[model samples]
Target chain A: EPEVTQTPSHQVTQMGQEVILRCVPISNHLYFYWYRQILGQKVEFLVSFYNNEISEKSEIFDDQFSVERPDGSNFTLKIRSTKLEDSAMYFCASSRVQSENEKLFFGSGTQLSVL
Target chain B: LAKTTQPISMDSYEGQEVNITCSHNNIATNDYITWYQQFPSQGPRFIIQGYKTKVTNEVASLFIPADRKSSTLSLPRVSLSDTAVYYCLVGDPMNTGFQKLVFGTGTRLLVSP
Candidate 1:
């Protein structure tokens, strides 16, 4: 089965540096999303994208965060300036639509570690 | 988004049947009950989902009562490898735009052999 794929399974960066996590969702999937889980915490929604534009975002997705689909397959999340609290497992997910019963395909996740 | 409540943890013996229930008292009519299993250092994996009644797949079973206020995930003959965190999510998903799954603090299961 086709699955979502993310790059840089792990990333370590300085507190003020920039970081980008890349993902390639299933080709046929039309919608994409980003979520993050701080160690031992619930997975929190970051943002959702569709029709080549952002649909919704959470409070945590402040001005510092941005998402882009640079090409047909690659979707990326960039943090302009990182903080220690930004360290977490960032996951990429995709689905055909927002069907109540639809299942979202998730990548293995990119572990971001900011020091 | 509906709030769900689940026990923090559970313990099971090898070969025992394990049932973990999640309560979403205010689940919307269009919401679906989905369960996911996660291991440390990896993303979560979908287990099973049900709108109502009982739905069973090769990996596990999902039981949703009529009120739609609660659901149960049943694992048969669980083994040591079955040890992991289980999450129950209840949502319409229509507004998330990506079927974005909102996972709660999952129920951690420890299987002893």
Candidate 2:
């Protein structure tokens, strides 16, 4: 089974620095999403993308965050001037299409650690 | 937003049937009940999803009442490998868009031998 894969499984960056997390969603998936889990907190959605454009974003996706699909397979999340609270397990998910029966398949996740 | 309520933790043994219940009092008509499983340091995986009555798959079963206010995820013959956190989410997963999903503190199921 094809799975969503993320790069830099572990990322450590200094506070105020910039970081870009990357993901290659499963082939044939048309929708992509990004979410974060702050340690013990529940997984929170950040943004969703489709047709190379952002569909929806959450409050957590403020000025510092941006998502891009610069290529056919790679989806990336860029955070400018990172903050300590931004440290969390960032997940990349993809779905076949938009439907209630369509399940979002996730990648192993990239653990972002801010110093 | 539909807020779902579920247990914090549960304990089960091998060969036992495990059922975790979730209540979403404000669920909308278009929302579908879905369940996911997660191990530590990993992303959540889809288990099952249902709109009403009962829906069963090889891995698990999802039962939603007529009111659509609550749903149950049933795992049969759970074992050690079944130890993980289970999350119940209600939402509309149509192509129109994806919402910023807020997964509550999930129910931790510990299945022992």
Candidate 3:
């Protein structure tokens, strides 16, 4: 089965630094998403992107965060001025369609650690 | 988005069938119930999805009643490797348009030998 692929499985950065997480969603998928989970917490939606534009975003995705489909296959999440609270496993997901019954394919996740 | 309620945790033995129930009292006409499983340190994996009635795949079976107020995810003959957290989500993608899923605290399932 095809899967979403994220690069730099582990990232360590200092507070106030900039970080960019990269993901390659399934080739045929049309919708992309970013989600995060603090250790031992429920997964939280960050943002969704479709047709090269942001479809929706959560409050957690504030000015510090942005997503871009830099190319045909690569989707990226950039966080500027990272804080200690930014430490978490960030996941990338994709779906062929944005429907009530469509299932998302998720990557293993990028573990972002801000010191 | 309809809120879901499920047990916080469950314990089972290897070779036993595990059924995790999730309740969504406010499910809408277009909402669908979907289940995802996550092992430690990994992203959630899709298991099964159903709008109503029973939907079964190679991995698990989803049973939704006529009222659609609740759904059950049945794992047949579970093993220790099956230990994971299972999430149940309810949403209407057509209405919301590119809906971002809201994941609640999922049920933790531990299968022992």
Q: Count of backbone clashes for each model?
A: 0, 1, 0
Instruction: Please write out the lDDT profile of model 1 over residues B1-113, one tens digit for every residue.
Output: 78999999999999999999999998988887889898887778888988999999999999988898999999999999999999998887676446666788899999998
| Candidate 3 per-residue lDDT over residues B5-71, each given as its tens digit | 9999999999999999999999999899999999998999999999999999999999999999999
Worst 10 residues of 1 chain B by lDDT: B92-101
lDDT of 3 at B112: 92
Model 3's CAPRI class is: medium
Task: Please give the range of 10 consecutive residues that has the lowest summed lDDT in model 3 chain A.
Answer: A97-106
Candidate ranking under DockQ, highest first, comes to: 3, 2, 1
| TM-score-best of 1 and 3 | 3
Which parts of model 2 have CA positions greater than 4 angstroms off?
Answer: none
Q: Pairs clashing in candidate 3?
A: none
In candidate 1, what are the lDDT values of residues A70-111, reduced to their tens digit?
999999999999999999999998887666677878889999
CAPRI-style quality class for the chain A–B interface of candidate 1: medium
lDDT, candidates in the order shown? 0.91, 0.90, 0.94
lDDT of 3: 0.94
